[model samples]
Target: MDIGEGARPGLRERKKRETRIALSWAAIRLTVERGFDNVRVEDIAAEAGVSPRTFNNYFASKGEAVAARQLERARAIADELRARPASEPLWEAITNATMARFALGQDDHRGAEDERWAEGLRLMVGEPALQGEFMKTSAAVEAEFAAVIAERTGTDADTDLYPRLVASAVGSAMRVAIQHWLRAEAPGTMADLLRDAFAQLANGLPTP
Candidate 1:
């Protein structure tokens, strides 16, 4: 349900979001343990303690279920950005909104000492089934982000380039930061990588 900007979620909205998140986590965990190809939608539904019919009501496929958190986080970021004070710099608002939504837009819910989840995430990432859904989700997120940017900056998302470009760049930067953290086994906090990525972007990405 679409609440007014800055409005608190009612109980029903909260419960629905929780269910979506639960299903998403279930899909991700099962994929991590058994690989994407092996995990069926029924398995994810069972893991999430919901019926397959209920899972179908929320998502179309196992891949969509796994990527559900991405949509949630992106929507959260858009709302966060909308709530920022007008006095705040656009880049700073973007950074803070992104931070509020997810740590570097990665699943940073794991403990700092826990590395197994990262490994699992890396392994699950290569599944062909998940990639297409993930890509589509990312595009949807970028378009939503661009619309929010246009609203904030008084630009036309459909015709003007600035909103779309900035949204895409921010999305790309977050993706790169998350990918680097996963692929390189980077020891730094995902927050640090995200901050550096935004800093470079805000600084016009001056050459080293």
Candidate 2:
């Protein structure tokens, strides 16, 4: 099978992915329930029905485990952006790729109702280790975005300014949209917020 369509992961690789996801979510939920400092690696492993050693094999720290899901989500978005048709506009491709991830039923990021979830997220904002891991994830994914955008625009990511600027702008836009959505009293769906954000981006943020 080629590297794309039919390249299914083997059983071991699939199992590893499952284990990693389980550990990641377990870390997040446990941390949210107990706060970051209270949630230990042992707790996360037990929650995921895996051994602590297995957790260690997958992640060096609880912060890394907790940040893994967000990293994976961003990675998926980057991959989707890279796969868009060559004819599609860059901003359009980015909007579509992000929307694909935040589609209703797949994930609902609107604030309210789930106070515990919101509180945990707020706590994560204050967590140095978690924030550091997330920033690292963002930088890595932004690099991925820069490379893909460069390819699409026929620019060099290393030496050209356009790719990095666009990548940074889009990344910041998404961050702002998500944070606002999470913090608002009755924030609307992520789709609406994302559309507005990307619209501003595509339109050069003209005065409202």
Candidate 3:
């Protein structure tokens, strides 16, 4: 569907997004209730109220389905960063966009639900098959951010590697910040932790 430039998401695109979200949540719920290994692709499709073929159309594999939500969220962050004003620093823009998208909310599922999703993510980290898919998605996000940064800095994304490098570094730092917050039993709020993390990045890290 048309989603770029002046194009708006059409009815089909909106339906696809809803279906994808439903499938992703269903897969996570099933995996949380039963071990990831115990849940079959067909079972997840059924849980999501879609046929197995429809599930494949949305996600290539079960693991991908499980990770769909995070990947979609990351893509949204990239889009937001690309739309930020050119006068803003690349890092600041990206950090703001990322935090705005993922920052904790009062109604957000950060208790048992979050823990379950985190466990699923932890499992994917060790799964060899899913590693490639994860890397591809992460690289796509980096490229999107890099292109935006390149434009703002008046440099070509191809010749200048700084934008790409910075994007990767920032993405890694954000991932680490989230992991740390999660490990801390997700105490306080995601917004607070994210603000602290992004503030450090925006202010520049001090050398030892």
Maximum-lDDT candidate = 1
* Candidate no. 2 TM-score: 0.88
Across residues 29-65, which tens digit of lDDT does each residue of candidate 3 receive? Answer: 7866676788899999999899999998988888788
| Model 3 misplaced regions, further than 4 Å | 1-9, 103-109, 112-129, 185-187
Candidates 1 and 2 compared: the better one by lDDT is 1
Model 1: per-residue lDDT, tens digit, 1-208? 3565436557668888889999998998988778888899899989989999999989988899888777878888999999999888888999999887775544454634567777778887777768899899899989989999999999999999999999999889878887787777444777777888998999999999
Q: Which candidate is the best by TM-score?
A: 1
Q: What is the C-alpha RMSD of each candidate to the true structure, in Å?
A: 3.9, 3.2, 4.2
How high is the CA lDDT of each candidate model? 0.84, 0.82, 0.72
Better of 2 and 3 by lDDT: 2
Q: Name model 2 segments beyond 4 Å from true.
A: 1-9, 108-112
Each candidate: how many clashes?
0, 0, 0
Which rank order by TM-score, best down to worst?
Answer: 1, 2, 3
Query: TM-score for all predictions?
Result: 0.89, 0.88, 0.79
